[model samples]
Target: MTFEHYLALFIAMFLVAVIPGPAVFAITSASIARGLKQGVNMTVGLLLADYLFILLAISGLAVVAEVLGSAFVIIKYLCAAYLIWMGISLLRAKPGTSITEPKMQSTQSAVLSGFLLTLSNPKAIVFYVALFPTFVAIENMTYPDILGIMACATLAFGSVNLAYVYLGSQARKLLTTPRRLTLLNRCAGSVLAASGVTVAVR
Candidate 1:
């Protein structure tokens, strides 16, 4: 890829990374319950999953992508329902009653949950497949150039996502009040559900 192509890819990926999704929700929920360190760890897991998906996208797995795309509507609805359930549960949580009171989730669970949450979204896979082709010049670019573009895109994605974790961690302070916490949960839930519906309809 040319420098201009890489820059464009970075900008596009950065914008997409900023949008809230299941991965963002997972990080925020983890931050609220477990603390910033755990939230960052969850972000790491998410990044790993994203890299895996990108690899699949680049490997010309168009058949798999098509199959996944065909089922994306159902997957999106399921994701929406799960987010709504989690949000309602959060809304109902008693104030000052710590979600981390019980034993913390194992590292494996955190990583696996993050990975599954990211990878299960077939739309994301298709998006990467479609997106990379626009900026990646297969004829003119060397392998190293392509790798560099991927690296930059990955770094941009991770950095933007970590910022979300930081934001969500700070939200713990504002969530001190039960009402405010409830409202936060509802709002996040609504956003997630709406995004899902939009995905399905699109």
Candidate 2:
């Protein structure tokens, strides 16, 4: 792909990344409950996951996509259910409830959770499967070109997500109040669940 093509793809991916989803909600909640460090860790986990998927998509692994696609409907519903459940749990968190700050998980756990969280969403899989071809010219592209594009995309996503995490951490002070925290949790949770539902329906 030309630089211009890559730029366009980056912009499109950025927009997609900005949309609220389970991952965003999870990161934001972690930030609010823990701190910026945990939030950033979550973002890094997500970036690692994105890189893995991008590599798979680039390598022409249609088998994975095909297998996942076959169960997309089931997976979508399960994800939707998980989101809604998480939202309700957040909504029900008691005021003055002290949540233990999350310690950094093992590297393997972080990467695995990140990959599974991202890969579980059939929408994301299908999206990369379909969108990757538009930006990457497989026949002519060298490995460096593919790696560069993936790295750029990962950086863009990580930067945006980190910003969100910082924002959430900054807002943590306001969330100290039990009522406020509950409300924020509910709002985030609801948004996540709704996104999942929308994905399932679509």
Which candidate number has the best TM-score?
2
Runs in model 1 lying further than 4 Å from the true structure: 67-95, 101-104, 138-143, 176-202
Q: Which residues of candidate 2, in runs, are more than 4 Å off?
A: 68-94, 102-112, 178-202
Candidate 1 lDDT over 19-126, as tens digits, reads: 776667667766765568767776777778777766666666576667676455555555555544444555455653544423335676556556655666544665
Worst 10 residues of 1 by lDDT: 96-105
Q: Would you estimate the TM-scores of all the predictions? A: 0.71, 0.74
Error of 2 at 177 (Å): 3.7
What lDDT, from 0 to 1, does candidate 1 have? 0.64
Question: Which residue pairs clash within candidate 1?
Answer: none
Q: Count the backbone clashes (under 3 Å) in each candidate.
A: 0, 0
lDDT of 2 by residue, 1-202 (tens): 6778778778877877888766676667656655677677767767877887777777675866667675655655665565555455555666555344323244454444444456565546666877767777766778888777787778677777788889889987777776777676666656655655655566
Each model's lDDT comes to 0.64, 0.66
Estimate candidate 2's alpha-carbon lDDT, on a 0 to 1 scale.
0.66
